[model samples]
Target chain A: MTGYLVAIATLVGIRALLALGLNVQWGFTGLVNLGVVAFFGVGAYTAGLLAVAGVALPAAWAAAIVASALAGALLATVALRLREDYLAIVTLGFGEVLRLFLLNEAWLTRGANGITGIPRPLRSWFPAHYDLFYLGLVLGCVALIYLALERLRRSPFGRALRAIREDETVATVAGKNIVRFKVQAFVIGAAVAGLAGILFGHYLAYIEPNMFVPQETLFVWLALILGGSGNNRGAILGAVVLLGLLEGSRFAKDVIPFLTGVRLAAAQQMLVGLLLVVLMIKRPEGLLPERAP
Target chain B: MAEPLLAVRDVVKRFGGVEALAGCSLDVAAGSITGLIGPNGAGKTTLFNVVSGLTAPEAGRIALGGARIDGRPGHAIARLGLARTFQIPRPLARMTVLENLLVYAPDQAGERLRGLVSRPKTIARQEASIRARANEILRFMELAPLASDPAGTLSGGQKKLLELARALMGDPRIILLDEPGAGVNPTLMRSLVARIRELHARGVTFLLIEHDMDLVTELCDPVIVLAEGRRLVEGPFAEVRRDPRVLEAYLGVPA
Candidate 1:
């Protein structure tokens, strides 16, 4: 029972990292990146493929980051030209395309049969402490990413990104290369997503094309908006809280009478959507609004 | 005596089939306050937009600092020391006045991905001076009191001031103002005119688009009149005020 709780905690921690990446893009830069799952999947697959092929965990992790960043850069090269809603559509399409590619590409990812036997980091050395070791790893990653995000939000470049979000014209007249700043932000966000993916892949020790679902991307976005879109801490908090609500609510059908499992699941999602609407209507700033002067 | 800071040579703009600027040409000399005066829809703003890289001309060459700048983006033109203000001030509502200034200031060291991972100290070092300078500019614009406020919260006049401050963040030689006095109150408009004159005295150049003839005459050394999207004539404000085309465009009379 304790192990199961720790596993869930690990999931929450990893999802929180993904939420922070989306927050930086959508909240600070006004960039609508709807394809976050693709980057995460890229990192996961990169890490998973390498780990299963006898590579060291650290090296596999390094490959995961490189793969994700490269994917982000490539996506930015093509999709950065889109504006607002168009950007959202293109990103969503790009994620779909990547998912389909993963689904069909058998030579590299073993197609839909999925890849397994992913070696956990330090598993041999800490055999009895596997769950705790992995928990520490995820927590360590979350801490590092959180610190980086906080510094980024306070930096000059981050401020420029927010300014670009407010008004691109103003930024442009002020001598900001609006396009360049945008691409940088998008790529960085994607890289963060990829990092989250690497963590998730190792935790699962299993990889399949379906793991990079569009629903997962939407959930990360929801977590970000829920946590306070522009704020890094808020994003992570939102992810854990929202994912908890989603998973925790499942236990209700077992305890309560007359409620079916499927009904409870549907109810959970509806409640999440309702919470989003209510938040947007009332505060619009999320639980943790952006820190402003 | 010096060559023009901004030269729009025989520019022509067509919207579908309607000719907006028909073979228009104008020269803004270095370190002078020049006014572009015309009635509503006279193509003054369009010409300004085209020159500042918001709109590309169908047939025209724009030269700034003795180099062509017709086909560049607005930011590119801005990087070339040409700044502009929209008729409606477009300050990013979400950012503070200081953040707005920092956004446009050239960032060579902080624009890269590696800057985040490896060059933290360099960015930190660069930002202190940039923030200090931004503070000084905000103070000069009488905006120090509200430097920390969200730019959207400012009054019409202050946002205009914020826009001007944003332009100056760059070392711009020429500024194209699209009706700086349009939404501002009378007193702030006077302050705006004063600021323009003061900046002019400091050797910055301007191509002001103004409907307020009084403000134009007070600050502009030479006023260029436009009608139906083309330059009609250019002369001293007093002379241009008395020009038939100028009067006709304003009052619809042959005064």
Candidate 2:
């Protein structure tokens, strides 16, 4: 039971990191990045490939971050010219294209077989309680990221992003380089997502293109909207609640017995949809609305 | 005279088949409050948009301080010491009045991500000084009481004041104010006029697009009138207002 709880907590921490990244892009900057999973997959694949090639874990993680940041910058440079809805469509398409690339490039990504035996950091030190140690590491990362993001939220950089989000024309006339700020925000968010991916891929000791479907992006969005879009604490809370809803539904099969695995997955999605509907009606600002500073 | 602060020569901008700005040319002398008055669709706002880099002109030359700025982006034009306000005030609604002003402070080290990390001390000091200046501007604009309140909570006139205050924060060499008197109550209008005069006295140049003839006559020096996307006449408000062409443009009567 302890191990199960620790695993759930670890997953929650990982998801929280992703949600935080999304919050920076969507919440603070008002960028509609529907291809979040592209950066996630990039990070996972980069780290996984590097690890499999016998690179140091830190170096591999760093490479993953740089790779994802560059990918984000490239996408923003190309697609930010298209505003709002077009941007959403383009990013969504970008994610699918990256996923297809990963699937077809068997030479690099090992095709559909995926990478396995990705080494965990400090595994030798906590062989007996490796899960607990990993949980500690994940939580540490979450805390660090949360604090950093909060500092950013209160900084001039964050203020400019919020201004751009509210009114781009106003921000532009006030001397903000709209494209520059947007690209920087994207790069930072993608780098954070990449870090989360490195942790996740290493935690599972395996990663595949299948792990980063468009549905995964939806889950992070749900978590962000559930917790509160702009509030960092709300983002973390949303991830915890979202993971709870998903993982708790596993026990529903035992209670209802008629729910098979496929049906159970369907039920979980419906549960999310229903909860979102209720959330939208009850507290559209989210579970923890952004507080005015 | 001594090289105008802003010079637009024969700029042309088209929207679909319609020409919004057809060979419009004007000059704003340094340290002067220049008024641009025109009838509906006379392209006063469009001309402002083109000069401020919000819209690109197909044919024209624009120079700010004698440097060509016709094709530059809006933010780049802004950074080159030009700032503008929208016709309908576009305040950063979700932010506080103070924050709205703070966001307009140019060249803050804290505005960069790397500066936040590499020069924490410099960022902190710069932020403190910027905050102090923003507060001073807010007080000058009589918005000190609403400093912490969201800009969206303000009345229409207050938003206008906030908009002007935000533009002032950038300390631009010249400001393009789009209809400063529109939608403002008379009491607020008097205060707004007073502020503009005070700033003008401080050597800040202004090119205002206004429908309020009284405000223009009281505040403007050399007024430029537009008729059908081209300059109708240019002179003092007394002379421009009396021009047969200006009357024809405003009343749609043959000059």
Candidate 3:
């Protein structure tokens, strides 16, 4: 039970970080970045690849962030020049390409059999602990990232990003480089997802190419939209709540034998999709509307 | 005193075979308040679009500070010291008034990723300067009390003021005001006109579009009229007001 709880906590924490990034990009900038998983996957793979190669934990995590950011910058440079609909198509394709590369690139990524034995952070520094130690490491990082996001949410740059989202033409007339600002927002968002990916890798001690699926990207968007597109606090809470409903439904299947295995997975995804649709219908703004500061 | 800061040379533009502008040209004298006047469908707004690069001319050229900028993007033209206000105010509805100004304020430190990380203090200082400057501009437009308020919360007249203040943030050499008095109350209109006059007095060149003939007569020195996107005449307001073509365009000919 303790291990299960840790797993849930770690998953929610990482997902919260991803949701926050979406809130900034889609919620604030009106950019529909359909390929968020690409960056998150890159970060996880970068960390995983580095850690298994005998790199230190901190350095691996740092490399993951930088690598993810660089990838995000490249993606932004290409994607931002296209119209919004075309951008969506290109990004979706880009994500599939990233997955295919991870699956086939045996030399670097070990292909389908993901790298395992990711070293736990702060393991050597503090020995013989479980809840306190693991929670302190994972949740603490989550908390720190959340606080930083809040700080940025209230900053001038964040405001400009929202402005561009609301009306690109007016922002341009206001002397804002609309494309430049949006690309910056996209890059920053990807970098955050990368950080989350690295955290996830260390927690699992295992990484697989198939693990970073498009479904995970959709889940992050679900959390962002469900919590409240414009609200960061809601984003964190949404991630937790969505995960609870998803994993909790699994325990329900144990009570009912018919809903087992593949059927359960389909049901889980369908429920989320329906929930997203219902949420949009009920309160398109979000579960928690971001209050004007 | 000085050569006109901006010169339009035989500008021609069209929209789907509708000659929105037909060989129209005008000179905006340096630091002087110039007015563009015409009735509805007279291509007054179209001429504004040509100058702002929202619509490029099919022929002719635009010069700012003696350099051609005929086909540049609106933002590029803005960065080149030519700023304009729209007929409709487009304030980033979600952001506060102060934030709207910061996006346009001079960023000597630049907005590089390193500047965000390494020169944090520099960014903060630049932000502070913009806030102070935005407040000053807002106060000048009698909008200081609403500086912290969301720009969308302001009244119609106030939004126009925001539009003007937004242009002022760039510290441009020339500003084109499109229908500054439209939909605003008389009291607010007077205030807006006063602000424009004040900015003009401070050497901000203006090419104003106004339906309020009284305000135009009061504020404008030399008025340029556009009818079907072609220049009709350029002279004193009263002369243009009495010009037979101007009267014929506005009131129509004998039955």
Candidate 4:
């Protein structure tokens, strides 16, 4: 039971990182980035491939961050030119395209067979208690990211981003470079998501293209919305609650033996959808709504 | 004669089938409150859009301080010391009233990611100074009491005051205010007029579009009248108001 709890906690920390990234893009900058899973897959693949090739873990992580940030910058340049709603469609398409690339590229991603034997960080040091150490590592990372983001949220750069989100024309006339700020925010958010991917790939010791489906992106969005979109603490809390709901629902199979496999997955998705509807209607700002600064 | 602070020459802009600005030309002298008046569709707003870089002119030259600024992006033009307010007040609605003004402070090093991360102390110091300046501007606009309130919560007249306050935060060389008095209450209108005059006296140049004849007469010298997307007359308000062409543009050929 303790092991199961630790595993769930670790996953919550990982998902929190993703929620924070999306908060920067969607919550703070008003960018609708529906392709978050693409960046996640890029990070996982880049780090997993490099680690399998005997590269240092830190170097692999750095490379993953750079690669994902570049991808984000490229997407922002193309999609931000269109209106906000069109940006959503473009990013959603980009996510599917990336997943297809990962599935078909046999030479690189092993053609959907997935990559295995990816080494874990500091595993040899805590072989008997690796899960606890990994939990600490992930939670430490979440804390660091939360601190950095909170500082940024209170800074002038963040203020400018919020202004751009509120009204692009007003921000432009205020001497803010709208394109530059949006691209930077996108890149920063993508890089953070990439780091989350790296941690997730290492924790699982394997990664498959299917793990980064569009549904995963939706899950992060649900987490962000459940916690509170614009607030960082809300994002972390949301991730914890979301992971709890997901894990707790697993016991439903035992309680009602008729629920199994694909049906269970479908039921989980329905639950998420229902929760979103409730949130939109009753508490659209989420559990921890952003306060005026 | 020195050169005009802002000079728009033979500018043309079109929106699909309609020509919004057709070979329009004008100049705003330094430290002058220049008025741009026209009927509903004479393209006064379009000209402001073109000059402020919100809309690019199809053919023309616009210069500020003798430097061509026709093709530059809006933010770049703004950073070059030109600021403008919208026809309808556009407050950064979610941000606090003070934040709306703080975001407009020029040369904020903390606005960049590198500056933000690398020099925390410097950024904090700069932020404090900017906040002080923002507070002062808020007080001047009589919006100090609402500094912490979300700008969206402000009344329409208050939002207009916030708009002018935001533009003032940037220490702009030239400000293009589109209808500064349109929706403001008369009490607010008087204060707005006094504020514009005060700012102008401090060497700030203003090019304002206003429908209130009394306001324009009291504030503007060298008012420019537009008719059918072109300049019809330019002179003092007293003289320009008496121009037959100006009257024809407003009232439609004396019919």
Top candidate (lDDT)? 4
How far is B72's C-alpha from truth in model 2 (Å)? 1.1
lDDT for predicted candidate 2 compared with the true structure: 0.91
Q: Model 3 over residues A162-279: C-alpha lDDT tens digits?
A: 7778788776666667778778788778888998888888878898888877888888988988888878888988899899899888887788878887889899989988898898
Model 1 lDDT, residue B253, Cα: 81
For model 1, the superposed segments whose C-alpha errors exceed 4 Å read A82-84, B116-121, B251-255
Give one digit per residue, the lDDT tens place, for model 2 in A226-268: 9999899999999999999899999999899789999999999
lDDT of 2 by residue, B1-255 (tens): 699999999999999999988898889999999999999999989988888888789998999999999999998899899988888988888899999999999998998998999999999899999999999999999999999998989999999998899999988999999999999999999999999999999999999999989999999989999888998899999998888888888888877
Pick by DockQ: which candidate is best? 4
Candidate 2 off by > 4 Å? none
Candidate 1 per-residue C-alpha lDDT over B191-242 given as tens digits, one digit per residue, 9 for 90 to 100: 8878888898899999999877778878887889888878898999989877
Ranking by DockQ: 4, 2, 1, 3
lDDT of each: 0.84, 0.91, 0.82, 0.92
Q: Which 10 residues in a row give candidate 1 chain B its minimum summed lDDT?
A: B104-113
Q: Mind giving the per-residue lDDT tens digits that candidate 4 earns over B1-255?
A: 889999999999999988899999999999999999999999999998899898899999999999999979999999889999988999988889999999999888888999986888998899999999999999999999999999999999999999999999889999999999989999999999999999999999999999999999999998999878899999999999888888888888672
Instruction: Compose the digit string of candidate 4's lDDT tens values, residues A5-77.
Output: 9999999999999999999998899999898898988999999999999999999999998999999999988
Interface RMSD per candidate (angstroms): 1.7, 0.8, 2.3, 0.7
Q: What are the chain A TM-scores for all the models, listed individually? A: 0.96, 0.98, 0.95, 0.97
